[model samples]
Target: MGYETAKDLTAGTCGGIAQVLVGQPFDIVKVRMQTSPSGTYSGMLDCAGGILKNEGPLAFYKASRSSGTLTPLLGIGLCVSIQFAGLEYSKRVFSSRNVASGTGDGSLTGSQFFASGVIAGLANSVVSGPVEHIRIRLQTQPDKARLYAGPWDAFKKIYRANGIAGIYKGQVATLCREASGYGVYFWTYEKLMEREMTQKGIRRDQVNPAKTALFGAASGYTLWAVIYPIDMIKSRMQTDGFSPATGQKYKSTWDCVRTIWRAEGIKAFTRGLTPTLIRSPFANGATFLGFEMAMRVLNAA
Candidate 1:
């Protein structure tokens, strides 16, 4: 009953700044690891350290003469806004129905909350699929002899190649990741934050940015735990084009997943886990904290 679209948008847009700011460096490393040919780096640290040493610190931001430090900023903001909007809308829809979850007490039960999160994730994929598509294509390519000149160039090239469909290279994988990952993501953090609120005798606003950040971090970790493998496929599918490696082209998401597992074993599931773990907490933590604060203010107003 209390959720508002304005509140969600305001919070999500605000939160996105922190999300990108804290996590961009680590994300660059993660993307490289995910898209690299098999037997590229020894591990996550090796990949990151090598990039730092060879490409210099600016490499972490995916910057160049044309692109700036703000990597995927709008993409993150759009995803958050769409995801939160879907979550809040779904929760509102279920708030009046005494279905499987709570008794319409205005407080969502665990299952209901999870369902809302999945819905949010699906909605987010609608925007995220293309946004990430461009980002990854540009990011994974080396500066010299790159396919697309820049993000705009990549967009045009992909559009020419396969039109809208090409722009959405990994929608299925993104949907899978968002649906399941976000389900556990919000449920874990929301449950934890709820317990903290109850035990600590604090209101939602009283939770403070620090605790909200911590909850956000927890949510990020929980999502990645479930979605890393799917995310690996999604990243691969997006960056598949331009790779010189033989047999890199995947027929489908399942095909990609199968081939990865068959060839690399289970470790393929978590190739870039180290950088991801390092970035998730800070990125998600700051994002959630910023979001909470924005929502508190906007909801009150």
Candidate 2:
């Protein structure tokens, strides 16, 4: 692969690791709220307190029992790596296309940035679908019930029960969420950075890492705001029970949405949103900061 591509991949990996490390505690709470029945906990604070009181402080980490490993540490890290790498790749493609077409310049327009994000999100969903499926399953499992021993065990059982399709239970919802969410994600980041650069009279390369992180956090908020409802459906579907004898709770994407709307009304779609919003700034800020730092280091080398 090209040096720039390799740099993107490595930098993305750094960002992913930072995101998961900074965000996993809030993530467990968010998943639990999203997947649990109504009244599972009063609200975000209540849910967090309950997990700490009942499940112990370590429960927030959701480590694999058998291997004593944090699942998302690797899973989400890889997902973020793919997301950033794909995003950069898509931007390069767009730039190349613009150059070939003799457009105004190779520099991406806002629309191009959004389109690049969509393509990145689509590519990311392939890995993210299954990673999130396992994560949601593990997260929503009863406190001590222990349905699956660990991430691999969960994968094995899920595969055995329903095969590859089973492992990717919420693939469709994931695709929808990722595409729309990331479109806004990159667009918001770019816009924020552009405005900052214009205001400060600095070149893109001269913009501060702290500023990049702040913009990334803003992008994260916009991403979830646009995609939270779809994400709710994806979480619910992933956590839904599948049985050979009885069938599935949510038959499809539409069915999941319909059931949620009927049973919980509009409020259900926003169940885990508080923690998500709380988590967004720190997690995504860490992500872009880490990425920017990694890229600088790589370039320096």
Candidate 3:
């Protein structure tokens, strides 16, 4: 790969690590709230308290230790790397195309940014779908009624039970969530950062780290707001049982949506949104901060 691609990948890895460290606790709560039966816990606090009380504090980082911290830490790290790398590459491609066509300057337009994000998100879902599936299974599994021993075990068992399709339980939902979500995610961040730089009369790299983080947080909020219902569906689909013994929950993506709408109300689409919103700011703030810092160091090097 080129130097720029390598830099983006490495920086994205840092951002992913920062995100998981800051967000895993809230993630567990969010997953539980999303996948659990109604009335599992009253709200975010109750869900968190229940996990702490019943499962211990370490329970929050459920599958990290399944095989020496490789599942989510490595999985998500790699996924984020692909996301940033794909985004930057797509942006460059679009910018070059626009310049060559004499349609605009080299700098990307807002629509270009959104399109780049959509491409990146779609690329990311290839790995993220299975990674998140494993994570959701581990997170929502009852502490006392554990299914798989760890991430690898879960993968093996699921694959053995249902083949390749089993491992990618929520692939469709993941694609939908990532496409629309990251379209908004990158567009929001770029607009916010661009406005700040314009106001300060500074270069993009000269913007304050604090402001970068705030922009990232804002992007995270907007992303989730646009895609929370899709996310809820993805979570439920990923957490659904795939074993021949246990059988499947919903037949298909449409089936899952119809089930949620019929059994629960439209309000159910917002389930677990609280913890997600709470987690987004801190997690995405750390993400952009970590990414930008790493990028600066790489550039200097």
Task: Tell me, by TM-score, which candidate is best.
Answer: 3
Q: Considering only N, C-alpha and C atoms within 3 Å, which residue pairs clash in candidate 3?
A: none
TM-score of each: 0.91, 0.95, 0.96
- Candidate ranking (TM-score, best to worst): 3, 2, 1
lDDT of 1 by residue, 1-301 (tens): 3447867876888888778888888988898998887799998878988888988887887634357565477778878878877887888787767544555557678998899999989888898898888888777777666777777888888888678878988889998888999999888877888898889998888886787888898889898989998998899898775333433478888988888888888988888888999899999998888888888888678
Maximum-lDDT candidate: 3
* TM-score of model number 1: 0.91
Residue 112 error, candidate 1, Å: 0.7
- Per-model RMSD to reference: 2.9, 1.6, 1.5
**Tens digits of per-residue lDDT for model 2, 168-208:** 99899999999999999988997788788889998776789
Q: Candidate 3 at 110: error in angstroms?
A: 1.0
Preferred candidate (TM-score higher): 1 or 2? 2
Model 2 lDDT on a 0 to 1 scale:
0.87
